[model samples]
Target: MKIKLYCRRALMTLLFICALYTTISSISNITLADMKVWAERVQQETNHPSENSLKKSNLEQKTMNEQTYRPKTLEEAIDFDQYETATVLATGYTAGIESTGKTSEHPQYGITFSGVKVKRDLYSTIAADPDIFPIGTILFIPNYGYGVVADIGSAIKGNSIDLYYDTVDDVYSQWGKQELDVYIVEYGDGTLTEEALKALNEAEALQVFRQQYIEQ
Candidate 1:
């Protein structure tokens, strides 16, 4: 009777161990399968970008470019509603040592601050305080027609301008220091790009600029 009882207990113990081993093996197999699936999903995303993500990236780049874009021309740059009439203290100057403190032998003799050669007479070159009128600003003087602000003077501050003349005699005889009525036709884009400056350095570029933007 004792031997039969011992065999029954041993059989029950063996069955319990077998059941635990089966449960552990099943859990291990399920965990390995889940890991394999997760790794494959990560690799797929790494290898190929989604169409929606690509479109989003492109849209972001376009928005950034639009925000940074600047107008390159007077027509595109200026706001006509901002135009106003102004009274200015006007002086006269020629490309001479007395006016510019530079001789013809100097490399920057005829060159204005905007990198353009000075043109004489009506609708010609003028100097002003760059703080008020930046390079490429167009002003219409009652007697002078139209003059572009392309230079700056040490003494020209606030509402003041130094009109350019062909000769020193013209400066003395025609225009001296006086008050003038001037119109602010259009404001400049307030930029001096190296490419634009280099192009303006050409002899005929001033004529082209005048015809395109000023003569009208």
Candidate 2:
């Protein structure tokens, strides 16, 4: 009988020890889970961009890259319109710099004239009345290179223009008086040409011309 009681007591003690160990293990598991959750929350609190923010930033950068800011050539200028103030669809003929070597000596704007300025003798120089074409205007001649309306001449009236030449040979040899298609690219105040037309409409000498050519 004594042996049986001893064996039974020992078995009960073992069972109690196992139960206590299980309880402790459960608590440790819960603590570990809580620690993991806290760590994840701290990570989120630190400075880090979310997936949505990263995507939006990338999209904005892409938009900027795709935008064409400034046009370098006439073909490129046609693709952009934000800088355009007025669009003139007209045709006329081209001449050379006036005689007496005036343009070569005293250039109006020093490599430029009126408000138009560019490098000396790099691109084809076109001169037009400031009242009509204004300074700082871009002209796209189909067969010719992109030219700036950087000068004016006394003979350059109505739709006439004088293209400058580096040498007298070029003046007489190539570009003397040739018909050209003029596309005037204007910017800034945007009202110069329109205002000039308004003034011409009120002129008495232009009455007949306005009815035939200017109005159209």
lDDT tens string, model 1, 25-84? Answer: 687765556768979987986798678878989999999998898554444444534669
Model 2 CA deviation exceeding 4 Å by range: 1-112, 115-123, 187-216
What would you estimate as the lDDT of candidate 2? Answer: 0.51
* lDDT string, candidate 2, 1-216, tens digits: 999999999999999998886787687765556768978876875668678778989999888887846444445534433333332332232232434233534554234344433221223446666676766455654434444565666666766666655445655665556664555544323222433424433556424322322111
TM-score of model number 2: 0.37
Clashing pairs in 2: none
For residue 161, model 2's alpha carbon misses the true position, in angstroms, by: 1.2
User: Whole-model lDDT, candidate 1?
Assistant: 0.73
**Cα shift from native, residue 140, model 1 (Å):** 0.5
Residue runs of model 1 more than 4 Å from their true location after superposition: 1-83, 192-216
